[model samples]
Target chain A: MYAFNYHKPATVAEAATLAGKHADGKLLAGGMTLLPTMKQRLASPSDIIDLSKLGDLRGIEVKDGVVTIKALTRHVTVANSAEVKKAIPALAELAGMIGDPAVRNRGTIGGSVANNDPAADYPAACLALGATIHTNKRSIPADDFFVGLFETALGEGEIITSISFPVPDKANYQKFRNPASRYAIVGVFVAKKGADVSVAVTGAGDSGVFRQKDFEAALKSNFSAAALDGKSQSAAGLNSDIHADAEYRAHLIGVMAKRAVAAAK
Target chain B: MPTVSMTVNGKPVTGEVDSRTLLVQFLRETLRMTGTHVGCDTSQCGCCVVHIDGDAVKSCTTLALSCEGAKVTTIEGLANGDQLHPMQEAFRENHGLQCGFCTPGMIMTAVELVGRKGHNLDEKTIREELEGNLCRCTGYHNIVKAIAAGAQAMGAKA
Candidate 1:
């Protein structure tokens, strides 16, 4: 890692000020992604504003059919959170499946969502559950929050404060992970609330995480894995890498979606 | 340069270090605690695993500044002086290691696993939980067996 100044702020306002002061300042949430990128010399910020000391950005609260997870809450916390498990077990399960125990101990949900890694698992749940991303400035719906691979709608110096997820009546997430890196080769999250249904696919989209409206519509009527029988999204515009081809990813999206639907309670 | 201070294995250590210095570097270089090895500088290998505030985290990926005032426990702190920790003994008795390169990290990870899940972990859970720690030497058969026994031994401790 290159030489850089590190600033630990006790408050959100202090963090914002520090971030604005430095020309190439980066906010360090969990540093799970940023640190590795820096170690490889892929990125070198002039200043790093550490948010781990900011107490305001850490907690889990569930109320009125919604679960609010603070941006700085670690992945391990979310996975072990009794409130999250009761309100949205699928979200907890997704959190548990990320990386491993060590990574989960340090990785944060906000960092994962903000980085918008195409292979990440949180964006699928955030989109499928119709969650809202609350920043220091304003709240953005999950659908509009993620722009593309390694991108989000967050403006300069806009720190994510928390994310609000509406507890679905039934939801489940399924992922086909790359054994080496443990990143999702293709993952699906399925959720149903009353007549509304959502099916989101991650790790397989060329434009990043996306929803399958057709599958959602079908599941809304039938509400079962059988509902998605003979259904498959187009292989076009999906990610193709050495690990998996676009066509195979597209096929796995359907397979994971069906499995998620079958697993959904 | 930045000053970093933390309680390592019960001793309060303070040092001046680079802002980008990793926790493993602080332990190995400044403090001369070489028990924590850096197997694969990338976070994938768990050779640098340590307890940061009682949780297993990769020291290589963690910044030294992030652990300010946090309690850290490394492989060297696992036992009493001259007496091996239960997990260490379990590894030896079970022939858990071949090269002994990944032993420190494996034991540290096992301690945290036992701390969280207790000694009654099932075989599938043990194999699944050890995903982060890679052992290329023993094929993981004896290591898994060692962890099971170590967990039981830790459970018997006060």
Candidate 2:
């Protein structure tokens, strides 16, 4: 790993100030992805603004039909939180499915959302549940937050403070994970609230996680597994790799969506 | 270089290290505590699992500077002097290891698993919990049995 200056700030303001001071600085949330990238020399930042010491950016709250999780809240914390489980059990289940126990202990939701890995599970939840990402600067809806693979709408020097997810009436997530990395080869998250429904697909999109409008429309009418019968997801823009071809991922997306719809409560 | 101080194995230790220094490197190099091994430095392998503030984490992927004032427990800290930890004893009794390269990490992960999941761990749960710790020798059958027996032993002690 390349040598860099590490700053552990006690406040979000201080962390942002440190971030602005360095042109090539990276915010260290739970260093699950950043540290590994640095170790491989793939990302060599001049400064690492460690956010672990920012006490205010660590919590989980449920209020007014929304579940608010702070930036530094670890995956394990989200997975095990009584409030999260009671409010949004599918969100908790998705958090628990990420990587393994040790990885979950250190990987934070904010970091995962910020990194916006195409195969990550959080993006699907964010998009499907219509989450609002609150940064130190402003709030951005999940639809506008994720721009592309490994990218977000976060500007330089801006820090994510918390993410607010509106609790859906019913939601579920199903994924066909890669055996080695455990990343989703094709994951689907289905959410329905009142008459509105949303379907988000991750790990299969060429541009990144995307909303499956067709599936949403189908479920909006009949909110059932059988509602998606005879519907097919096209492989036109899906990701194809050694693990799975685009056609295979397209097929898995439909299958997983059916399963998610069937399992959602 | 920056100075980092943390409590490891119940002993306070301080060392001057580069900001890029990994916690596993600090333990195995600066402090000369070599019990924690680094199999795959990329965080895929759990050869460097350790407890930080009573939670299991991959030390190789964790920065040393991030652990300031934190309590860290490595594989070397598991046993009480000459007496082995229940997990270690169980591994030995069950012959859970073959190459022994992944034993330190496996034991560390197993101990943390017991702390969280408790003693009544079933076979499926044991296998599922051992996802991060990979045994190259494919000695998982005995490893699963050892973790179950070790969890029960730890429960008896408690």
Q: Candidate 2 on A1-265: residue-level lDDT in tens?
A: 8989889999999998999889799999999999999988999999999998988889999999999999999999999999999999999999999998899999999999999999999999999999999999999999999999899999988999999999999999998999788899999999999999999999999989999999999999999999999999999999989999999999999999999999997
Off by over 4 Å in 2: none
Task: Give the per-residue lDDT digits (tens) of candidate 1, residues A119-163.
Answer: 999999999999999998899999999999899999887889999
DockQ of 1: 0.91
Q: Point out where model 1 deviates above 4 Å.
A: none
Q: What fraction of the genuine interface contacts, i.e. the true contacts, does candidate 1 reproduce? A: 0.88
After aligning candidate 2 to the native by TM-score, how far in Å is the CA of A137 from where it should be?
0.7
Instruction: Considering the two chains of model 1, state its CAPRI-style docking category.
Output: high
CA RMSD per model (angstroms)? 0.9, 0.8
TM-score of each: 0.98, 0.99
Per-model lDDT: 0.93, 0.94
* Alpha carbon deviation, residue A139, candidate 2 (Å): 0.7
